[model samples]
Target: MSNLFEGSTFCIHTFGCQMNKHDSERVAGMLEGLGALPVDTIEEADIVAFMTCCVREAADTRLYGQVASMKNISVREGSPFNKRLIAVGGCIGQRDGAKLTDELPHLDVVFGTHNLGSLPALLTAAAQEGGHRVEVLDAADDFSSSLPTDRENAWAAWLPITVGCNNFCTYCIVPYVRGREKSRTLEDIAQEAQGYVDAGVKEITLLGQNVNSYGRDLYGEPRFAEVLDAVDATGIERLRFATSHPKDLTDEVIARFGTLRSLMPALHLPVQSGSNRILKAMNRRYTREHYLDLVKKLRAVVPDIALSTDIIVGFPGETEEDFLETYRLVEEVGYNQVFTFIYSKREGTPAASMEDDTPREVIQERFDRLVDLVQRKAFEANQDEQGSVVPVLVEGTSKRDTSILAGRSPKNQTVHAPLPAGVEIDELIGTTVSVKVDEARTWYLSGTVVNEDA
Candidate 1:
């Protein structure tokens, strides 16, 4: 088994959320442990894997297209990359299982969300059997976050405090595919944070389906605030989390924004819809007023907090008035950014079966309106940063201009700064720098170093 595929290389193309990206890192770590090298292109690799997402319908279409392309390349009898093993894993793999193999005959292996550890062995089986293998586990005894990781970014890491979802919003497919809520022991999480710090990681975002509800299944109450405190005590420079449900964002959790020194000032609370009627229909468990109230509390505690949110523009029964309420809410609470989505019916979700008679034009119009409002607010927020000195965690050179380095401010705004004299961009990839904002755009800010020594 040790020499089965020695000296081979693998390329993993990951699609979807950060969790899937983290999973791909673990996969790479596992592959490297099996004596595999990482390759940039699938054409040059002996193994190709896809870590997929099933959150939206388009992912399925994209997956099919990619597989079809791979089939053309890898399935040829005399092709140079003919020996490559094509593996599929994550939510899409977990959802479709053997059907993926049936649909795409060239696919060699399919592993599930809970069985990322089994991938190497499954590939081995596929190679040995001269046939395909499917290893889709309902759940795993251990968390995938515990596996070795080959992090792409040296300055940051994702530490999963919990996995799976407890809040099965009718439109969501996460709980079905990712399974029920399971919180990692607090000790494990804290220890992981300390490890990241020791490894030169300056920032870590705690990962979960609903981060604010962390520890509820195990501790009988949500202890996310305490988790934040534990990680903050590790002396990590920056802390953040993602996709927090508006209902589960308790006052204690919101209060931590003001108290935790390392915690970033940005929050991504997703309020799916703005009308109470639409909210109840989606089983969101919180009303529009409740969400606005939480926003007020967050601002009250931390006046300069930068807020962002997710907005679903068109649900099954959303009315013109319902969309106006969403528009009103967006105007009422100016978000630093809003991730707008026109509702797409996922096959397994309850919403897929409901009547979606809302015209496509209406949905598109609402989506455009929301997008415009969000962009305006974001531009205004960035503009406000002008004539101010903000601390940014330098992430490396900007993709748009290599001469200009970029980093993120405490509020999670991208601040692109010119490299100071005789300083290389690589040297500041992980350091915090004080940047004086000189220019502000809708999505980012351009600044100069205000205090290099600071």
Candidate 2:
């Protein structure tokens, strides 16, 4: 009970992207190394650390509010919850280390991107001497160290093949905050994938800021295909990666996907905009035709591949015609889903310094129109699956009703079906089950489980 790690339990509250989520895994791995058991609820935790993010202003505000609320929870208890050592970390800590520590003195330990390996030692120090904030943002460490993690689930897991980003996209903050692209060695990544395969991980989403740009620092060129081949060699049932740069998605990589059966029928290729002017403004190296070409390549290999994209509607000087150009591309491609947003300017990005021509109301209107187009396309796309039987890896029970079960198809469509009679949750997981599409919503699909084993 003296050291926080030696205490009863610990919980990690993570924010931001997949990279941050992977960082939380390393944080958990560190705590477990120091003899800490993961707690499901903060109420039961003797130590709680917030793996924070500061990309969105809202992420920072939400983290502070969560920590402050936890403090109130501790105070309201029969005994002071000061015994529960609270901590804050990630980009927020990297960006505002001393200021954050001075502001929230209740936090036990605060660490930045570079201090993951030193976390256990820091936690030990914080427990004895009280609250401490240890941030080393500018100092990006090179050594790749391993840590302990209490995985969130079994069948599905996020396997980080790389860390950080180098691309200084005009409107992005990741490169500055997370530092240059640092890839974990191929052997390390493959070993991690093997571990998941051994543990019965059926579906693995290989994560990174720009997945296609993986291994450029190590193998000389972007070796994402090599990484994929290595992971696939481990005999993992399913494989996927995301947030690809159109420029880095070479012919070899797209061709590899065609041959790799495990690589599913879904790809999250984020084409920020369809206008050549807007694309150049955002510092995306690929042109509008290039993105369409990449989609065509992916479609040629996997015809049923579901397409999803990220589009910022009113990026700085976006004109109405530019917005219409984006809409026209959406209509032409008919993506299964489109993530549309009115761009939020980060203070340091190149685009932020540019003159803002698009009005706020206009941005909102354009965003709404983009969303409307996506909804109509999604409905039309699902209409084709009306009577088809599809195979899905049953994830678990449905959220709406436990009487039903949930899973995902090769295209990564969320499907729910009645709980198969006499089927246990353990048996249902990690196994391919056939389901008939009974109905389709804007997002998820309703299905009925078939076969006794399914």
Candidate 3:
């Protein structure tokens, strides 16, 4: 291990959700400040960091496989120059830091969710002394920023308004891992949005474990709408947010999306199961009818708002009827995207203790059926967008072909078109370009950019 500053290139492989993506940005900023440039390939890096997650057991397994490959490549080749210094951090690091180090001796540093601020210091020590270090600290501690964040893009940024969760859902590990909810000050958040605006950010998603419950623990009341209005005043071109809980969503929040031009017409609400019994078993608090009613009300406020949802196919005691109810609900809503999953019992969660009589083969069968239904619904939904023009934000050249540039709409639909010279991300990144939906895929659309309308 060598000082992070000693090398000029580093690569980061981030897993999990937008929160983890934000964490990666923070790490990138710190690395850049330490004089390490970002490298897309691991072979050319001085440090290679893996930001991991354990929300799903599959994610945990994925990390181990990656670690094994890295160890094999570096140990067998005996080339530190090309191998790069390996580091593991984030949620998986918090859960399995010591165990990972004991199992894989090649890792140079291990940091956790609570120790993001200490990443630079850990890298410094690892480089100078050469060995392994773990800095998880405590799970309950709040992370107040004393770190840099080299945001991967300028137009879009994830500003963490709050972190952690208080709701102890029977099927979720977030409460156990992320600790208690801690809302950052309103001034801090508003100021952060202003900073992003100053940095040419056209859009900002105020992120949190439970966004609608923001400021309740600190400001003594729900101030999400107030904060939204405050951020809107900053003149950011677009606004978006995610993962809203059904119980916490309010009319005021829904109404703002309609009135506030920048608030994009899209929201992802997780209705884990359509059956009330399963919802109760999962400690979700809201019923299926209640969620549907909420969706109806949201549509009333924002007529064209795209609805997306999450569905868990087989909870412990799910029956065929229960699965059918979910499928029917999926059809009824006509979700833009359905994040479907078969339940995986998390360790230390109440669901793990409950009798999961539903066999894996049965769950797998149901999951496959659910996915098939989602695809049919998705195709139907995308077909409606045919001949309709969509406003999209040009991201960059498509990964598959550099001859074409790609971007997303305010609603986050991916669009690809030819890359014209002299066009920069800032000039065309956030600006709306009319994309004719001549061709549509299950999730994205391929269309030529309309120059006059843009």
lDDT of 3 by residue, 1-454 (tens): 2343744678899999888999999899888887777878666566889998878889888888887777555321433343357888888888777888898888878988878878888877776677887878665354434468888777789988888888788988876667777888888888988888998898898888789888898989878888789889899888887657888988899889878877888898989888888899999999989998988998888766777888887788899998888888898888888898878778988998888677789899999999999988887777767777788877777888977768886667677776556665456665667777788778887877776534
Ranking by lDDT: 1, 3, 2
State TM-scores per candidate.
0.97, 0.93, 0.93
* Candidate with the greatest TM-score versus the true structure: 1
Please, what are the lDDT tens digits per residue for candidate 2 over residues 255-301? Answer: 88788768887888888899999999988988999899888888898
lDDT of each: 0.89, 0.79, 0.80
lDDT of 1: 0.89
State the displacement of the C-alpha of residue 101, model 2, in Å, after optimal TM-score superposition.
1.8
Candidate 2 ranges with C-alpha deviation above 4 Å = 1-4, 75-81, 139-145, 452-454
lDDT of 1 by residue, 1-454 (tens): 6576677788899999888989999999988888788989877788899999998889889988987787556432432233678999999999999999999998899999999999988988888776989999888789998777899899999888888998888899999889998999899999999999998999999999999889988899999989999999999999999869898999888899988899999998888788999999889999999999999999999887899988898899899999999999999899998888889889989888989788899899889988998999899878789889999899889887888988899999999988999999888899998999999999999889976565
Q: What TM-score does candidate 2 reach?
A: 0.93
The segments of candidate 1 whose C-alpha lies over 4 angstroms from its true place after superposition are 74-82, 452-454
